[model samples]
Target: MNEEIELKELLQKNKMYQQVLDDIEIGIHVVNAEGKTIFYNKKMMEIESMEMEDVLEKNLLDVFSFAQNGYSTLLEALHKGSSIKNAKQTYYNNKGKEITTINNTFPIIDKGIQIGAVEIARDVTKYERLLRENLFKKGNTKYTFESIIGSSDKIQEVIDTSKRATRTNSSILIIGETGTGKELFAQSIHNGSNRMSKPLVSQNCAALPDSLIEGILFGTRVGAFTGAVERPGLFEQADGGTLLLDEINSMNPTLQAKLLRVIQEKTFRRIGDTKDREVDVRIIATINEDPIDAISKGRLRKDLFYRLSVVSIFIPPLKERKQDIEDLVQFFIDKYNHLFAMNVKSVSSEVWSMLLEYEWPGNVRELEHIIEGSMNLLEHEEILTYSFLPIQFRNKPQFQSERNTKKDLDEMLIQKGRNIKPLEEYMEEAETYYLKKALKHHEFNVTKAAKALGMSRQNLQYRIKKWKISKE
Candidate 1:
């Protein structure tokens, strides 16, 4: 059921409403029944490369033309008193630049009489000549929710959140350090979602250079450049499924703008083609760096970040969830033992101390690699000992993990009188309680509560992600 939004009085404020419309990212064009342009926004001007003086109050047919006798979607909607949803329109602007857009045209009905039409547009170009149905089927994902192995409260909470995310088609941004299983969670989400029947394609944004990645994403047009041929891109192949963009911050900012258009309009332009191609793929981007930091450094566009983080999932690092190390070690041992026909029971006390003390710079992937490397050397030994460890494991870490809280020093002083404990465990409980109170007081508005908490919204968000605070 659709909920009604009260905007009668708000929309009646013409100047304010007009300013809001012009500030929108998507192009908005309004025309009367006679095809005279009544409203044209700033974004529309940018999209069509026309000035406000030339477009407003002018006839739409005079400024632009549908190529090859193509009918106008907006005019058609007005005459037929209907809507043309997700329709592609190709036309030539005054500058002679071929413009292709995905338009949602709707007619305005005043007391059952057709008054005018409005068309929202986004610029897109695409080229295609390849069939990818077979490739889509062959690259189906193997991981599901069950494939993820962890039992810590933080890991379980992240799992629950990911399971809930599978019910929606919204874009997701998974943020974590390298080797934190960001792609593993992405695969699990895809396999559990309604779109599971469709292929789940993966791409490493940094795998190719900028010039080549564009061609890889949107495909190339024949004669686009030397040695260029018509071919489909990942967007075409992943249509009706999911596209997992690993290390999305590594993508060029220029291409990031193009990706934003696709998210907004569900259409994209090919590398060298003028025609726009529509697709229905869900985007899931993973970033190894802090997104706020990425935006500050201009590696990521803020607008793109906003769109991509519709459902943000932050996976805690291995050091943050050290309690799970023992369980993870056992799981990996069982896995490698089965694969290598070894009967290794468990690690020795020395090996266990080394595993728990040393900081996992490579996270879970590093742990699995360590276990696999040890399994190869285990021939007759029933128990994995320190001798089977890697060369770097000879020296144990002397430092403990960080306590990211304001009260770590104060808590340490108090803990000496009671029992010895890491400062993080005590801070986690207090921090979680205070954050919940602040959020509840603000009716769960993160922006307002974050301000009240004397922290940036991103900082508050990180804390919430770490603590797994349920706002809904």
Candidate 2:
């Protein structure tokens, strides 16, 4: 009788412990050595669209018969008595709905005896759906000329030139430093043109190797090469539309020659086929370096450069357009405020001064990131201050070279002396700066940032909370 009572108490304790796991968002499942389910959580039922009665006490492989072939992480873990982490699995459920999950499966061992296996799953169906929807079907553009956020003469000049280019079908070459919104101009020009209803396909020339880029851009024919199948390339896929070739200088000279022929003749021959396939695709190529420098260095062919530069546009860097910094900062703050569901109303004078002084090497993208990082850290505070800026901005060494002369340094020192604050205030600002910079540098990946900062993740999280830093 006493043993029976003890068994019931132990089961009650186990149920109490399992309740915590049941409330989590990730799906959890456990099956014994016999493959019969011992535990199933509410999230698992929701993820699989199944009821508890249908899964509990059922054989794991029998419940998910698709896994009976020993291809699933659960089955692999059961057979190997080892852990499998982040194994991506795709299968159809009983209702014929395709499900994809990133799963972590591991065997559960009690003492030296194998007891069961556990599996945790995270659903990524919505993410995949978004990717597919954006890649095809709609052929819609997300940004137009209005999305370009600057009122400076230089920026307005580029926007005006881009607008003019939209009326014609001539090839355009965009030259700008990294992060100067070259792609933004390309998309805006495409969306504003007569081919707005057609697809606007984009490919980075630097992203693929010479061997594959040809096939991807011009496609292949059946029996063209050893296993070649008939396939439509980007040119065909983008027929009657626009094709934006980003980082055009990175394309191989041989591929450049072929591209030049296509640009001039308005036709291309597929690999392994002698017949020519004509395509009407408006070309917009972007280069992150000076065209002359690229040609001189042999990274870009002279003839190809001339062919592409018929209509050229240059976007100035952020440092060159200091007049637009305030406007850009406000734009980003508003954007992130909407995204993060916060009410950040104003920027502190100290922060504004700091922003103006810093030379943004990453340009507009870097400014956007800085604003985003600051907005994430905002809590109840309505005003953004120097304390919210990243460490890269607070440190002198990072911006000392940009000060340029002794006069500038002296003026900066005078400004600092006039604005002398309390030691505790300075220390707090320093801490917040380092924390924000670390988080930003790691792309808001808390685990990696915590490791780099030489602190435990939990402790860093606590500090983030206390400092009102943004995690997302």
lDDT of each: 0.80, 0.80
Best by TM-score: 2
What's model 1's TM-score? 0.55
**Tens digit of lDDT per residue, candidate 2, span 1-472?**
9999999999999988788888899999898887778888999888888888888897654456221111567756876899999987755455534467899999998898888899999998677545434543344546789778766668999999999999999999999999999999999999999999999999999999998999999999999889899999999999999999999999999999999999999999888889999999999999999999999999999999999999999999988776567657756765666568777855764565567666788999998888888777789887887678776665667445533443463454446548765667665665777678779988999876654453345556656876799855
Considering summed lDDT, which 10 consecutive residues are worst modelled in model 2?
61-70
> What's the alpha carbon RMSD for model 2?
21.0
Clashing pairs in 1: 125-269, 125-270, 126-269, 126-270
Q: What is the lDDT for 17 in model 1?
A: 85
Error of 1 at 423 (Å): 35
Model 1, 1-472: lDDT tens digits are: 1222346554568878898999989999999987789999999888788999888898775577543324578777876888999987766576544467899999998998888999998766332001112222345538788767665668889999999999999999999999889999999999999999997989999899997998999899998999999999999999999999999999999999999999999998887799999999999999999999999999999999999999999999987766567657766776666568777767764475566656788999999899988888889787788778765655444422222232564564466568755667766776677679779989999976754443345456656876899976
Query: Which stretches of candidate 1 lie above 4 Å from their native place?
Result: 1-141, 396-472
* Global Cα RMSD, each model: 26.5, 21.0
**Candidate 2 segments exceeding 4 Å error:** 1-141, 396-472
